[model samples]
Target: MVTPENVSSYIQQGLECEYIDVDGDGRHFEAVIVSKAFEGKGMLQQHQLVYRALGDRMEQIHALSMKTFTPEQWANQA
Candidate 1:
């Protein structure tokens, strides 16, 4: 079974994000990710990027609820 730590590590490596919050019970997760890489991307693209980061683990992980934002959007929210 995939763990939260494993998921966090994967996302960190894959996206190189500045801020990330991951909460889950291994099979399901909710993540709030902030990265400059999302600046020009639409919602679908952003989610796709994160999904790609998770790799095939996405199949193992079940549900992933994500709140993605660009660096600028994160800064504004803060």
Candidate 2:
């Protein structure tokens, strides 16, 4: 019953994101998240922040793969 939109909202609610996109098929999800909070964080720390945001809702997500980036980092990708 967990839709991608729900997942996206959860992340947005917890983190101050510049941009976020999530896609999934109920049980598994993938997200690309951009935020100023990610500026100096390492990959593991970035993921931890997202996990903290998800909180208890993480239990409902069977799998989650994400690409986290700082606002400047994201802009460089284009």
Candidate 3:
């Protein structure tokens, strides 16, 4: 089974993330992703970018919950 760390690593390989945290059991995962690339994107578009990065492995993941943010949006959250 693929680990959450592996999933995080996979996303990192394809996208430039400022900060990323992922947690999951073998089948389900949640991720908080901060990146400059997310700027100017809507919620669905942001999710599509992540989905593109995950590629085929997305099928293996039963569930994925993600909170995506631009660096500025992330900073403003606090």
Candidate 4:
């Protein structure tokens, strides 16, 4: 069973995050990730970075929806 915690862990292991929140039921998940790595990247590129972070673990996930933001972007979202 792939819990939100597990997914969040996987992402954190592969990427450096300022903040990350994940919520899900088993295989489907939604994540909000804040990272410096996403700075100057487009949405698609940001997503790709996350996908790379997940690596082979992505296969276990049936669906993943993510909101990626740089530190500045995250701060201003409020």
Clash counts per candidate, in order, are: 0, 0, 0, 0
lDDT of model number 4: 0.98
Q: Pick the candidate with the highest lDDT.
A: 4
* lDDT for position 27 in model 1: 91
Q: Give the alpha carbon lDDT tens digit for every residue of 5-29 in model 4.
A: 9999999999999999999999889
* Global Cα lDDT for candidate 3: 0.93
* Tens digits of lDDT, candidate 2, 1-78: 999999999999999999999999999999999999998999999999999999999999999999999999999999
Kindly report which residue stretches of model 3 are placed more than 4 angstroms away from their true locations once superposed. none
Model 1: per-residue lDDT, tens digit, 1-78? 878778888988888798998889979888999988898999999999999988886788889899999989998895
Better of 2 and 4 by lDDT: 4
**Which stretches in model 4 have alpha-carbon errors above 4 Å?**
none
lDDT scores of the candidates, listed in order: 0.88, 0.97, 0.93, 0.98
Candidates, ranked, lDDT: 4, 2, 3, 1
Sort by TM-score, best first: 2, 4, 3, 1
Q: Residue 9 error for model 1, in Å?
A: 0.7
lDDT tens digits by residue: candidate 3, 2-77: 7999999989988999999999998999999998889999989999999999999898899999999999999999
TM-score of each: 0.92, 0.98, 0.96, 0.98
- Assess the local accuracy of residue 28 in candidate 1 as a C-alpha lDDT between 0 and 100: 87
**Residue 8 shift from truth in candidate 3, angstroms:** 0.2
